[model samples]
Target: MKVAPLPDDEAQRLAALRGYGVLDSEPEADFDELTRFASELCGTPIALVSLVDAGRQWFKSRVGLDAAETPRDVAFCAHAILQRGVFEVEDASADPRFADNPLVAAAPSIRFYAGAPLVNADGFPLGTLCVIDRVPRSLDALQRHGLEVLGRQVIAQLELRRKLADLARARDQALAGVRAKDVFLATMGHELRTPLGGILGLSELLLEGPAGGQDGVADDLRAIQRAGSHLLEVVEDILGLAQLELDQPRLRPRRFDLDELLADVEATVRPLLRGRAVALNVGRSPTPVEADPTRVRQIVYNLVANAIRFTERGSVDVTVAREGDTLAVRVRDTGVGIPREKLALLFRDFSQVHGDHEAELRGTGLGLAISRRYARLMGGDIVAESEPGRGSTFTLTLPLAPAT
Candidate 1:
């Protein structure tokens, strides 16, 4: 008996076969059905969907065969894979190469064999869909054609399985990257806040000392205070965003009055309007809500502060009222209205829409992003409407009930 030699492109063919990840896999119904069909069409007692591994021929699907695999040296399918078309041995017992082969002389007593090479899209023959008969016989033209068609189907199934696995791996990798980014942001935010708090506290104390009355000295200290305060705000926004992304935002909910919360937010942002010609007008009616007051306050403050920064000489209006089962808080600014195209960037992290006054109104661009996250976390959302020169309105809508 003659042993089948390896293909000319043995390494590449093996690599291509391994890529499918089908070797030694459990029998699948799709492949089993095809093997059964091949056996019936060829009038063979034994049929197989065989994959040739480095040292063995593993049967992915088999009919009338008890063993799962056979050594490659004695595998009839091994020789078949080297051929482009069907390889047929009319009488294996009479053929010199397989007459003395163990498969022909042993238990199954194979006397006839026909196999269609399973060739992939890249033209690598991975294995075969083959049939065996104990009695000497040959498959007609139609039977040979049917066997080749089934072989192509096997290759198609393998290709599909590989593609699905690739997509799953890609999705997992993208999710891992997002988690890593969140962790890094959370760590760095905490690290920077310690020093920033000290700077702001020291600057405040210096400004209250004898330097408070010094003209140039007081101005310098105030500048330091302002920069420190802005940096601290940015760090806080980063921490908030990272916490939300990590899905660990611990919200403490309680029953609170929406009108009173708005009042406090108004007072907090009124100081920011000291130099600008913006008038802060807040309209409210008594409204109760069940949610985290701290998060709600932060969202409202962000919206009001954002409006004041953009409006150079216009009115910023804050209004709150109940609409059915939800409460709506609208912050409308007469500042340079956002361009229609830039509206979508308002709530995306690190994304900013620049206008004529963007230089003076520059920010970390995380305020709106963080606000929207908090609103949604508590069963609410924020939306914007604007006309280019007429100003913009950001409305925060929240359900009156606590979030589940």
Candidate 2:
């Protein structure tokens, strides 16, 4: 009998299987106990947790067998992964596939075989929990059930590994973000200090020289003050982003008019829309909402900022309306709309929708994520809808409070 060629992706699967670093590593008694129980329940002479690699089957745990591995070309685990469930062969001697197989006719001379596919967390079959016996015997219904149960335990092990991998990735991403923040901090410090030094030096010169009496000196001082204010706002945003990442307390509830608050937001963002062929349309309403004032302002600012940022040549409309007991504020922009696939990741930290606008835009990618956290803290939520190449709308909804 000729051994069939492995799949085209079999090599990739083998590489990933070995990447787990479990194969050929030191054995733990936890896995050995599992294999021992499987063999005892099946009444088989050998039980092995076999990981099918490209050219070999590596045993995670082996019982009643001295050898650690065998060629995958003759591995039963290879066949087991081809199916979703267990693969059973009561008599390999009669089957054409294993009639002249070296493992069957040579060393093991195995006639009975039972294998339950071990699937990973992502539901990809990696290998098998199998039992081999020289004497041909079929498993009863109860024995088959037992093998299936053991397969779940093997899957649990793989799931644990997957969780560990995910945790490692998250930790790495967080570390990288911290490093970026450090660099930003250094740059901000230099920028801020240079301007502050200039302002201080200019003020001293003006106070001591003839420029102190000149009207232009006052204008220069005002410009210096405005620049300092803008720098402070940037610094505050960085601090707030850091606090939100650390999950610091957010709720500081206060009574505020939803209409007035929204009007203020419109006034603030309208200037950003000027010269872009974008107009601001604010919808008025008589609704009052109870929420954290600072957080609410942040949500409004970030939403409006995001709207203006994406809209190159279209209008950004802000609407505040009362629906049932909820107050909804919508910020809509006709810009480079987000892709449907990426909308799910919009609120995820550090996930920026990379596109044509990416080259012209500079952001820390933490705004939406922070806004969502703040919204949740105030017992409200933010939702988004976007059509690719058309536009996007972001809505923040909060529970409306009765007039007091």
Q: List the residue pairs that clash in candidate 1.
A: none
Which pairs clash in model 2?
A: none
Q: State the lDDT of candidate 1 residue by residue for 1-404, as single tens digits.
A: 99999998999999999998888787789889999999999989999999998899999999999999999999998899888899999999999999999889997899999999999999999999999999999988899999999999988888888898899999899889878987788678768988898987787788779987798998888778768777777877877776776675889877777878888988877656755888899998666777799999999888898888788898999988788888999999998888899999999998889854466576788989999988888888999999887899999987776444
What is the total number of backbone clashes in candidate 2?
0
Each prediction's number of clashing residue pairs: 0, 0
Regions of candidate 2 where Cα sits further than 4 Å from its true position: 1-31, 82-86, 89-101, 104-111, 119-125, 134-136, 215-219, 222-404
True-structure lDDT of candidate 1:
0.87
RMSD of each: 4.5, 12.9
Best by TM-score: 1
TM-score of each candidate structure, all chains considered together: 0.79, 0.50
Candidate 2 residue 397 C-alpha distance from true site, Å: 33
